[model samples]
Target: MIDYTSPIQTTFELQRRSLEQSQQALEQSVDIGQQISESLLAGLDSQEQFQRRLVELNRDTVASALDAIESLPGADVAVDDLRENIDDGYERLLDGHEEAFDNISAELEDGTDSYDDLTAELLETVEEQLDLLVEAHEELEAQSVEAVDELAGQVEELQDQAEDVQAQIEQVSEDAARAVEA
Candidate 1:
């Protein structure tokens, strides 16, 4: 006799394997996203550090120039002019530094926001897929139970029919024996 449950069992196994693969892929995607975010933050931190070092170097150079100007003999007017120029340069440098800092701050904030949005979207997609898988599994389970119940009923009917056929065969054998004796 053919095993009727084999096909159903194979189908369920295939679906289970597919679901496992999908879950693994989702996990990998989340890991990759986290790595990318970490890399971006690290790069931003390095850039900020470089900018600070550059500002410090520029300040030291300005101070050194002012000391050199002060040491020169018979150059009072030149010293005054040099001081004014240094003041103006320092002011401009500070303003530029502030502007660059603001721009970087805004860019970093925007990057963080974008990362958060992407993460939220990915999570939502994963949740939806999981829900669908769960629904499919529940439906399959219900169908399997219904099929088994139907098969059981058919088996019971076949057993009753076999018993009736056996009774008829016994009656015929008894009649033949009586005829022979007569």
Candidate 2:
């Protein structure tokens, strides 16, 4: 009456589902790695734009400084002021680029660390599932042993009943022979 197939099916489904989930997690990790790599390589900062802006500013300052100096030879204060402003702007531009590079580097490092952590967590989860599977297998083996023991007991009982029936037949034959003789 016990449909033993049910437990086998249940175990099989559990294993199947666990494997599926593990596979999905692996794929997701791979995707995350790819995205991170792309993001790192894509140059996600305004450093290049800032450099271009600095170049334009320097060109404009040089043109204006030259014009001011050429216009008045006696006194040219605008040229010196323009040069100083241009130098300051260039220094600030360099500093901004350095800061941008540092920021981007830090972001990439953080992303890499996070990816590693995610992968490690996924692997740990899979390991835990495998451990559970091993425990389930051991439990099934124990149940099988119990079932075999029960079957053996039933077989032994059947054998004893067969022997008792054979003895009763032999005794009935002996009684019939005695009756015929009487």
Candidate 3:
């Protein structure tokens, strides 16, 4: 006969191990999900700010270029008028950049504030529920202890009653024996 059963068993075992490994990996991912969320939220505002800073650096580079142009040796053209227009344009561009950065910062601050508020509210609710759960558990434990103690006391009373009844029966039997002899 072919060893089909042995191969099937081996295949099943391999599949079982594979499933267990996958389950463990999934469990580990679930465990870290919260940490990942927290980390991303923590970085959210800062990441945007960093990007804004990098973008603003272009302002400095542009200013340096204008400064070099202003320092250029006497040109054949009307440098003052040319410089004036360039400076005006630079001023407008700088204002726009500053305004944009300010607006973005304010928005980020508002968003982060709201996010923090919501997270805090969520945490408070969870904590309250946990406290209630603990209180309920404690009450249940106390009730259980009381019930067990009451049951034990009843059992002891029943045992004492049984022994008393047994003693009475022995006494009655002795009395009967004495009566018969008399």
Candidate 4:
């Protein structure tokens, strides 16, 4: 008996692997963007204008990443449900940052000696967040790059196998035609 399931099974397996790899790559890219934002924020020296701009850019990037993930072909479920959480988190974080900036501005206008302390605290917080962001960004960048390379190799392999199979089929068909004419 012919093993009729082999070819279809192989094709399905390839497709499934491709999908998994693609999803992983997408997630990794988002993580890298988040990290970059954090690192950039950390480097700022407590300048109010700098902080405000960083916050805006980070929030926008996070929102865009969430949107991309949400629109994936098979994003119905996730390991951490990160897609849903990310958008809301970015929005809240941005709002909080803005509010903090406003408070700092008010303090500056009130001729209080508290601006130094407040700036110090804000700088510390930014530093901590930036450290985390940098780490996450590096890790994600490696993962995404590896995943993409692996997926490309797998696709090339699958294409070669398909072409081989096609050639065999054509050769068999030609032989059959020759035999029929004899």
lDDT per residue for candidate 1 within 71-180, as digits (tens), equals: 87866678788778877887798788768877876787688678778877877887788779868886886689579767977887887788888888888889988989
Candidates sorted by lDDT, best first: 1, 2, 3, 4
**Most TM-score-accurate candidate:** 1
Q: CA shift at 145, candidate 1, in angstroms?
A: 5.7
Model 3 lDDT tens row, 11-93:
54565566556655655654465555556655765675675576557656765675677677774255567667766876786
Comparing 1 with 3 on lDDT, the higher-scoring candidate is 1
What stretches of model 3 exceed 4 Å from their correct place? 1-76, 161-182
Lowest summed lDDT window (length 10), candidate 3:
1-10
TM-score of each: 0.63, 0.49, 0.49, 0.38
The per-residue C-alpha lDDT of model 3 at residue 54 equals 66
How well is each residue in 1-182 modelled by candidate 4, as lDDT tens digits?
A: 23434554555456556655665565566556556544544443257667678877886887677677767777747613775577677678778877886775555444333433454465566556655765665566556656666776777888899999999999999999999999
Error of 2 at 83 (Å): 2.2
Estimate the overall C-alpha local distance difference test score of candidate 2. 0.72
* CA lDDT, every model vs. true structure: 0.77, 0.72, 0.65, 0.64
> Per-residue lDDT for 42 in model 1?
77
RMSD of each: 4.8, 7.0, 15.2, 30.2
How many steric clashes between backbone atoms does each model show?
Answer: 0, 0, 0, 0
